[model samples]
Target: MDASFVIHGPSIKPGTEIELISNTDVAPTAAQLLSVEMKNVDGRVLTKVMM
Candidate 1:
């Protein structure tokens, strides 16, 4: 997909302030699972799981 946008504003004088804002929408994706391992003082695999 394709899109375009534009914005306009007025000029500011001395000691004046102005603000411009824009917003966009985005889609979310699925999360991936991973395995984690733990070790003890003897350096041994304790358990593994997906997260």
Candidate 2:
């Protein structure tokens, strides 16, 4: 499968790009954005995109 992610908003920097990410990361990233913690996960939040 081909996977790509894009984010656009005031909190996100313009023209940011991520080379790769796993499917499991999507949920964790969303949780981070909501300021919620995720437990018992095999993946982690992709903080690079937020910067």
Candidate 3:
């Protein structure tokens, strides 16, 4: 399966393209954007997507 998307916003880094990422990372990334820190998260934040 191939999943793709486009994220465009002030917070998203321009022309960012991460070749490796986990489905589990979605929640952590969202939490970070909401300024909420999760404890012992199963996945890490996709910081490469951020500016």
Candidate 4:
């Protein structure tokens, strides 16, 4: 998630699904924090982050 997309006010519960739409490339550091592999819609590996 981008810095701008971070919600600072409340705690989000588990199982909550948030949709993120970004046109700009998400930094490698950010992808690592999210623990989700950054890839294109076609399943191409853009970056691999540890889960």
Taken over the whole model, the C-alpha lDDT of each candidate is 0.22, 0.80, 0.82, 0.39
Cα misplacement distance, residue 41 of candidate 1 (Å): 44
Clashing pairs in 3: none
Candidate 4's TM-score: 0.23
What root-mean-square deviation over C-alphas does model 2 reach? 1.3
- Best-to-worst ranking by TM-score: 2, 3, 4, 1
lDDT of 4 by residue, 1-51 (tens): 454443221233333444553534345335545566666542222222222
By TM-score, who's the top model here? 2
The worst-scoring run of ten residues by lDDT in candidate 2 lies at 4-13
Candidate scoring better on TM-score of 1 and 4: 4
lDDT of 1 by residue, 1-51 (tens): 444423222321233322322222110001111233322322322112111
Give the runs in model 2 whose Cα sits over 4 Å from its true position: none
Model 3, TM vs. native: 0.78
Worst 10-residue lDDT window for candidate 3 reads: 1-10
User: Higher-TM-score candidate among 1 and 2?
Assistant: 2
Instruction: Tell me the spans in candidate 3 whose CA falls farther than 4 Å from its real position.
Output: none
Q: So what's the TM-score on candidate 2?
A: 0.79
* Every model's TM-score: 0.19, 0.79, 0.78, 0.23
Q: After superposition, how far is residue 11 of candidate 3 from its true place, in Å?
A: 0.4
